[model samples]
Target: MNLIKPHDRISLAEKIGRPSVALVVDDFYNRVQTHPTLAKPFSIVAHWQEHKQRITEFWWIALGGKPTASYSYDPVSKHFLAGFNQTLLSDWKALFFEVTHTHLSPELASAWQQRVEMIGENLLRQNDKLLGDRGRPST
Candidate 1:
């Protein structure tokens, strides 16, 4: 139940071009990869080039575009595996909005903000639920 108004849910694929998405993904990851709290887990990423491509594809899909060919990364699993605690997720969300604000107009940024918040919160909740389940015995 996303309470976001229909008009606030503009298509990122249509409003923001793929080139802009690519740029944001590149810039965002560049910063994240070097971020003190984010760097270590990302160090396991063997190929920066491929990782960036996958990130771009992820943004493309998230922004309401058709799925990129074979872009199937599960963000929650990856983040959980990498031990992303609440503080790390908060930092990541903060940086994400900062990057988006730099690239988009206020309206577009606001629109994307709602969507991003919803997605991030959902992922965090799901990750927590799954982690909790892991500690319980199977039925």
Candidate 2:
């Protein structure tokens, strides 16, 4: 899928809103568990089921643009600091796009893909600056 235009992103995010975000999280977690590269890292968590549900809720909150009374940590950094690396990130994003393509409509999938690509690009940039280049060069 092609990257979504910036103007379309807001509408796409609105389309996803809360429920779609929950569905994406649920689908993503299931895919992660089944994925060979991701399964092991996911297994490291003590409460996989609970963690998965919380992640789903977290996405709902994030995409819904709701105000947060409680502080929430960024899971990507949390995982990375815990030793998850670029390989995992790449694999996860691959699976994520796969799931998105399979589950969401083309327009929604394009929007989500663009958002994810943006986030992934930023994360890779930060990771490179902090840790030095540890994987293939960022696209």
Give lDDT for model 1: 0.80
Compose the digit string of candidate 1's lDDT tens values, residues 71-129.
67778888778876667777888898898899988877777778888988887787787
* lDDT per residue (tens digit) for residues 1-139 in model 2: 8999865566444677666776777788877777888888787768867776676655545454554345465755666665556777788788988888887898888777877787777776666665655554433
Worst lDDT run of 10 residues, candidate 1, spans: 130-139
Q: How many clashes (backbone atoms < 3 Å, residues ≥3 apart in a chain or on different chains) does model 1 have? A: 0
Flag regions of model 2 displaced more than 4 Å: 1-11, 61-64, 68-71, 132-139
Clashes of each: 0, 0
Model 1 alpha-carbon miss at residue 10, Å: 6.8
